[model samples]
Target: MEIIRWQDDNIVLLNGAEKRPMGKCEAQAVSTLLVIKERMGEDSQLTLLGCAVGATAAFTGFHRATVSRHGPDVLQRPEKQKTMKEMGKKERARHIASKLTMPQRAFLVKEIHNIWADKKYVRVESLWEWAKANISYKYKKTYFFWTLKGLGFVFRKLNNMTVVEERPDIAKLRVAYLKKKKDMDESNAFYGAFDETWVHDGMAPTSGWQHANTTMYKKARMVDIESAQSGPAKGKQRGKRGIVLAILTEDGVLPGSEEILVDDDDENNQKADYHGVMDSNKFKEYMSRCIPEFSRLAASKGRPGVFIIDNAPYHNATREKPPTQTSKKADIQQWLKNNGVSYEAKAKKPELMGTLKNFLTRNGGRQAFTVYEFDEWADEVEGVKILRLPPYHCYWNPIEFLWAQMKATIRGMGSVTDSLPIVRDRALDTLRKFSPSQAAALFRHTRQSEDDVRGMLEERESVEEDTSFELLYEVDEEGVMRNVHISDDDSSEYVDFSDISDFDSTQ
Candidate 1:
């Protein structure tokens, strides 16, 4: 075969004949012609071998007759062409390796070739799995398979590789964000509102508690008409009772300015017909007295802050409605504004309620302390902005912290049968054990420290188990695994419980 150099030829050759020149020729066609000639033998004539010749002539330069009469037999040099074909695979492998990064190339070398040259770890599925996990791109797997085919790598059916791994950078970024937030909270003051909720656990005291208490025990009933007619003994029922003092504090710290009071919730109101803490007149009296007092306590001397409370029926209970048929929220707001205190009803949101629940739930419904020591609680505490913890996170409040300590101390102690003074004194003794200064110091020193932040992030970063193609298989009488498919289209269904229950069992 004549091994002619590649060039843009304007003429096409048929089996053994040359055709007239056709204008400008394509360079790729010229090269392909030279390649075909080198693949053919030396004395081969040009033209007439049918479709390939016609294609060659059509692509490069030629007339139809030359290609039809004399084929592409002129371009066959089978021996040398085989040599070129052999070089193609190795060259392609080199180009692919060159395209990869050092780490990726090394991974491929170690994983695919086992670099030791032993072929011990040269697993196609393992390589595919590694690629699927690490090489994240829309066309990565397709390109990878093409390259693998070009390399002559044995690619048996892999275990259906589909599990995509999370990038480490995402975890690193998340941890950084959490750390930043924790840092921001370190110097800032958090504030919240407070409220109380009572629940029944079933217990009742008879004679000694109070005349009012005894009356409540005798008077309160589920069936109103029957209990009213039946008399005291018939009305009494047995059940335990408990209360939750919810204080939503800012950043889980109790405000040193305010004190939480737990009192005997009066059950023996003269106007027991109304479904509330007090009757109309008593409700009005309560608002007129307590609202001003609480506002005075909650607001500052110079810039009195607004207080947020829920729009509960108890708060809006009024003796009369205006001609405009105005609601109680307006009345309360008016009173608060008149007294130099502003008020707003909190938005009904679960997140706010969650913060409150965090505090109240932890304290087991009891947060006892006296306002008498408010000065001592607030004294000399620098970097301590004593704002009310928002209305629900009482568990985080240090006052509740103190209360927790007290509750733990007296968990199994006999119930308080003594007067309110004795109970108050005992509570004071509990407070004395946990000094506010010491608690505040502890919080300042360890406030959402780096270690805590990391732990929180790690908990959040906890790996999600990969179950992308988890399959279930069962055999029929013919003994073939049946009805297999991919699992869990929704990412949230990924549970790490990791039981083999996901697989089919032969009965």
Candidate 2:
């Protein structure tokens, strides 16, 4: 190939001695050369167009270095290399998109749109599925999601909802209180810890079928006196029947005040495969035995604190049902009238108590007390105060922490086959082994995370939005968007929103 120029200003290439114009296919080629020369500078002209020999070589594709060496040219350019790199990227994206099918194109567009539309932005994969079902399957699920993300669609989550931080002051205070109480020193502080746990009829043995069976039988038999006495003797039983007792105490080692248990293993309990009996007499018997401990705990060190408990029928012999029906709250009111414990004002929102009740019912009734032999147990624990958690506010009671810890520890342990007594024993033993510090540690781990707390606050703030701006917009008979920009003097348009809804002024 050869190239010739008219006075070196205009140049042309010749293949095998045939001259060609710098036009058509060769025009764009020559233009590129000129651009490169302008980029490299006038000094580079010789290697690019020194003579027919060099021109021919340049036309045939010589490296810029070779051209620069012969021509010695430098261009006044800021970032020629960077522009070329960006061009490559654009070309790559175009090439990939061109390979996709028409259905994929539509799906990608719709998925991006759907994610943008959701109040809580949808994830790319999830968004792609919606787009795919509604559009076409030309795109792969994973690819489509990433493709959209690459284009800048964002999937957002409430980042501030978790509790990232805690009030260290409160934690420090709790530690100080515990220490003071342990030392048995008097301080103005009302230092105390409260907790509640269900006592199963009995706990299952760690090993052996015989031991486990015995434990189950022991738990199944933790019923109150009425249920134990009314039923006919089983296999000619001779001694007084044992009673199952559920007591809520202060310290695990101390006896509690309020106590109740199954009177008998009725048909309901049997059907449910639970052999617990509800005996009011047995319940009363257990309560009497624990009464002194309760009194002692309440009057501990000559300082008295009111014991709080829920309004359970067994607590103070109140009406079983609420007063809204034929059964009046008065029935219960009368019992509390003489009882030492005073009922606080009923909770405004009882739903809060759901967590505690659900925990109780789900774990089999508090039958562990039966296996513990409460009367004998109470005789051993000198003084303990019993306090029932006020209804709908189980969260206030520290015992909620105990259950929370237990649930987390036994999250996936398989089903229980032995019996209630065995379950109770195992659970109680586990509880007994756990120190207050260990219990507190478990509570810390199980509670919600920091981000969760912040998100809730943000969510609460969002729900309470200002509506004053709503009056700025108005719709009329014409199907066109309009603004109601009324001034203070425009009383005609100042109708109350409620009244405006009720009117038909057009009629």
Candidate 3:
């Protein structure tokens, strides 16, 4: 083969005729010129343009340098081909869709994630409408949904709830409170936490087992006590018609205290004083008497009581005052009856107010009430200096977990019944099994969660989003596609790069 050498603007065929060379080739063809420059110069071009012999892929770069650079494959970058192979499905889809407009395509992915983050379901039609409104690209709802599904997206139920972002101020206050409690606890005191939960016939939630292959699930059963009406239960025994009030401590139920049942039948029963559900008056009487009795028991064992309790309305530091109108007079009468205060039911408004105020003064008045009983018998009574968990912070309470375990046991029992005796016995039996060691173990779970929350609340100097707007896709359960929520704090999910298509145009 005769070699062709380039002169200024012309090509010389050493063994043939000289000819004027073609001008610079297309910008798109600059890359492939390196692949065959040496061979093209020596004899033939890469291809004959069409069927005519003279037509060929013309070279553009300087002859000597181009041949040298193109001669070795190792000198060139493999980035273009590698990028195509490693590109995620969503990324490639975004790129293809970007032909219409890059901004809209990029914006749509971000909007989908934003809608999902807001806990609003993004339907296909909604996304299609949004794109139509924002861009000139017209897309059918069906087409968009199908394309998204094909590109790896599935309806995934959200499982995480936004927790209260712990501020350093809030954590500081909690630390101070905790330190105060610890100082009080270090004395000769029995550290006892109290929480209340309502137990009814259907409070035990039954769980259903499903086979691994079952693709569809029916509606799930929910244990919603609030939804239960006062009417007779359908096709089943009546639910236990009362509240079970019990206090828990380290060892077990407070000494000399049994689970108190408050229901309709209590008012007409022997000890009329203890009948009915919890109210402000009933709560005050219980605190002044029942808790004091428990405190005595704690003192007997060489420990005063240190009660850890929640702040329910009945356990408020101040009680509400009753209005004195005829309609409201009955309210004060009811309060008197509930607290077992001896008073004339037909008494005038002024007389009734004076008597009630006197009684409230003897007990804990609205102004004087700290919700802690002042009893000097257990030595510095003031209701044993109660420690309160922060509002909405249930992670510090272990009794909540205890209630869950008891309910689980009740659900698992084959002989579980709504009948009073059976329900009462099962509940009491469950409570009896809660030893001090079990309480310690369960409380550790709460303690660990507290530590995790505290660690998460550290002052950060810099923060950033996990995403750089990369079109990421995730999958679970073998081909079940799920939309991944990427967080800077989470590093578990890996973006899938299985999707690839022809990128020769880009190459």
Candidate 4:
């Protein structure tokens, strides 16, 4: 007797201590012979059956039978055999996709490309949703996904290794900042870095000891047991928010320079972040109060002071707004006159704008027009200067590290049940503990970062200069092109359109 067992996608034939794998065709042939033998008893003649079937039945230890009981019509037909050669799963999916006309396929590919370009990454479900809405796709989502895969679409997680600091413009800014710092160091200027941060009463240590069998939740806060049992809606809030403005110098954190503003309004407390609570006006008011202390500290050191501040929007509030093409003619005229720029009395808006652009270009561009109010205020105090740090380069600011140390210390001593006042007090105490040695160490670390960035910029510039090449060609009257040699001093002149606005162009 022959026993056939299915293993995965193949058929295994076991017969009397012998076993062998069989293809689909061989298995079908064996099954057909077994059915024929069952229909016609073993006593019937075997010659009527095909020689192939008789041989297969004998090899598999099955008795051969004649087809006398049932006519030859019992055999598998040619059409049935043809149907067995149908397409496989993947082939069928591709065939379904091919049903769309060429233009339709092109349209889908273009739309999918556009979506991916805009979003950087997309999911199969999102593509399907878009297709259903835009193209009225009638196929199942799984089939659509398969079609996408067949068309060379693949899913992958987006990479986040790239950063803004790697850009050429940002690198140039870093180099310029380092050069300025170098000059300041040579002048023996005092560096005082200042920044703002926020904290909440729910703040706690990110790590702690816990039971071996239990999981630990960092920053977990205490909640009312009865209310939590009822539902999340009845649980206590995260905590009250406090915005802190701090200053740190080589001598240590300036006394009375730590200002903590607690959000007492219920509506404000419900907000996720506290940045909106502080703005340019509030920041200006705070600076007004701290400038005197800053001046005193610099005098004590007997060195010129350079107030290093990050380029926060609030810190860069303009004293006077710059005029644009959209400004009224009177406003533009007044601005030009105040800046001592001469223009035709009957000059149109566009002409006046052109005159203004020339004046600004000769000076320092739009930056010269937009002067920060804080910078002007700082200039009032002798021996004090304001220096804005390059954007996205927070490591260059020592106050940032000071804030981190203060927060860590506060979190380590804070409790979930602590009130806003307790949290504020803890933060103040932590700030008080920051010694001059710690502040100096942070400043040294910042200086090291500056050196590293300077090295990076120098290396990048060397590589760029080594690889830089230019091809200049000239076409003679005979329409023949040839390479043109030019000296380094022979520079081409081009119009400066950077300061030109859309409105100016239209005019």
Report the CA-based lDDT of candidate 4 relative to the real structure.
0.65
Q: Deviation in angstroms for 411 in model 1?
A: 4.9
Best by the lDDT measure: 4
TM-score of 1: 0.24
Per-residue alpha-carbon lDDT of candidate 1 for residues 1-507, written as tens digits (9 for 90 to 100): 111222232224332534433334444556566666666645224543223544455564656555444444444333432232244555434333334444443344345533334524444555666765765312244345544543334445654212211333333433443454355455343333333332221112222323444455456554363443222222122112223333323223232422223334454432222234333354344334433433444344322322223323444433332212233444444433443543335623343334333433343221211111221223222222223222222332334444455544433232433333434444444444554465554344334343444563454456463221121222333423342222223223322212222222111
lDDT of 3 by residue, 125-155 (tens): 7787787777654545544653465334566
Point out the worst 10-residue segment of candidate 2 by lDDT: 233-242
lDDT per residue for candidate 2 within 1-507, as digits (tens), equals 234343355445543345545558777777776676666666665664544445544555765445434432221123442221243543323333443344454455555444544535556567656655765444565445434433333345554321212333333333332333323323221113333344333222223224334544455567533332222222211111222232233444233322223334432334232224433454456556655655565466455332323333344443232222233455444433433324445622232233323433443332211122332433355343233332333443444555555433432231334344444444545455556465444323222221232233444457664232222222233322233232323223222222222322221
Ranking of all candidate structures by their TM-score, best first: 4, 3, 2, 1
Clashes of each: 48, 58, 1, 0
In the range 1-507, model 4's lDDT, one tens digit per residue, is 444433342334654336766678877966875676557754334554434335435555554443212213322223431121264654444444554444455566767656655756666788777776777666666667756754444455654333544565555566667888988988998888888887777677656754443322221223433321221112123567888888888988888888799777564445554556877889888888887788888888888888999887778878886589899988899999998888899999999988888887666456547778899888775447888786677768899888888887877776666677888888887787789999998988887666655654555566644222122233343433333222332123222323323212210
Error of 3 at 214 (Å): 15
lDDT at position 484, candidate 4? 29
- For candidate 4, the per-residue lDDT at 62 reads 53
How high is each candidate's TM-score? Answer: 0.24, 0.29, 0.43, 0.52
True-structure RMSD, every candidate:
29.4, 23.7, 17.8, 21.9
Q: What order do you get sorting by lDDT, best first?
A: 4, 3, 2, 1
Model 4 residue 443 CA deviation in Å: 1.0
- Which prediction has the highest TM-score against the true structure? 4
**Candidate 3 TM-score, C-alpha based:** 0.43
When summed lDDT is taken over every stretch of 10 residues in candidate 4, the lowest stretch is 227-236
